[model samples]
Target: MSRVSILALALGLAASSLALTASAATPSANTPSAAITAAIADVNRPQADRDRDGDRKPAEMLAFAGVKPGDKVVDFMPGAGYFTRLFAKAVGPKGRVYTLLPGELATRSQKAVDGQKALAQDKAYGNIVPLVQPVNAPVFPEKVDVVWTSQNYHDLHDAFLGPADVAAVNKAIFDALKPGGVYIVLDHAGDKGSGLRDTETLHRIDPETVKKEVEAAGFVLDGEDDALRNSADNHSLKVFDPSLRGHTDQFVFKFRKPK
Candidate 1:
């Protein structure tokens, strides 16, 4: 072939390669499973008299937790049945989602009491089982693949519960999971080195403190994801102080029980 003809052929090949690369880089329209997508849509839909946005992150967090259609899951303190519904759908009909609401909350908070009552009757959440036991109680019928808690860890440090009670709660969760099971936690971020101070005022907790505490319970820190990181947060303000509210900086950690 002539030199000019050879150059033109090379250019054509390069153009084709570029086109293929572009196509490969573009995200596909393939969505999450129909069941999961539908459940997420239902949770995001606006409801009458509901003030807080669902802020559902199960789709993202479940990915981090490596939750599968057949994995058993436990949603600790599944307030208003938000994550409970998501877990129920993600685990599908074959898997189970135990919605473990602290028995203390059920007895003290009328809203929690009503929510649990409503969840018990929801047909859509047939895979969900409500376990109204104290946080320290091992009421799970079977070992779970994933034990997940979101925005509720800070409450464990409340004055109403002492250190022993909090430690017992963590241990109970540790015992309920199978060896190699995952424990995924997502909570508001507090100031670095603030210890548990944020738990009291801002309803947040230091990520370092959480790691040390869970490690003490025989959980290994598998990994952490920066998907929820927000650099703008100063971490001094309360999560509910209007300035932070829905956009507060958050941390996500994945711990595992050793097999």
Candidate 2:
């Protein structure tokens, strides 16, 4: 063959090899990595009802937060370390999970103190770190990939935090997230126009109010998941009341810091 003909033949062979390699590199859904399977299994472990039951957030919510095996995560007011333990395992050893304890209440509340002690003793949670801060202060070391708060937003309006303090807390959350980082909030839903009244009596807040306050802190409303929706909830019962404890109408919202 002529020199040009030989060169053309070599190029054709290289292209075919490249195509074959690319096809082989694609990952399949069922192809479980040993590390990921182990992490998921740990998350599925059976535990006491108090620690495990309340931690049963919808799987979709975890996906929406973009939680991976090695991303830094912060669980705000991780009262009892329920979600904190899950996050610690989900992130694996390569990732870190910071359980932000409400500083003002941590030392004063017996429950918070006991929870912290228990979490510290768990060998499976070596990746977890406890951060103590005032209810309105965000004392995380730096911005993280995800900041998760569950059923605690209404407490922001409680006498302890109040409106002004809550706004500061919101701003702190915004600052604690990296650009494009996610803030996942799950809270009980109050009456549509009840404003902040439900916060005091029912320990709930209107969804609209949550959206407005979070948006005011410079986060964009990314999306919401209805996985926890319950049409049977009348939105008038207190979240801690026996009637609503496990069945409150809850809203799940995802907000993102702008890149």
RMSD of each: 4.3, 7.1
The superposed Cα distance between candidate 1 and the true structure at residue 56, in angstroms, equals: 4.3
| Deviation of model 1 at 259, angstroms | 1.2
| Count of backbone clashes, every candidate in sequence | 0, 1
In model 2, the Cα lDDT at residue 225 comes to: 80
Runs in model 2 deviating more than 4 A are: 1-40, 43-46, 49-55, 160-164
TM-scores of the models, in the given order?
Answer: 0.81, 0.80
Residue range 65-143, candidate 1, lDDT tens digits: 7777887998888777766767777778899988787877777788886787677668766787778887677588998
The residue pairs in collision within model 2 are 103-133
Predictions in order: lDDT:
0.78, 0.78
Q: What lDDT does model 1 reach?
A: 0.78
Best by TM-score: 1
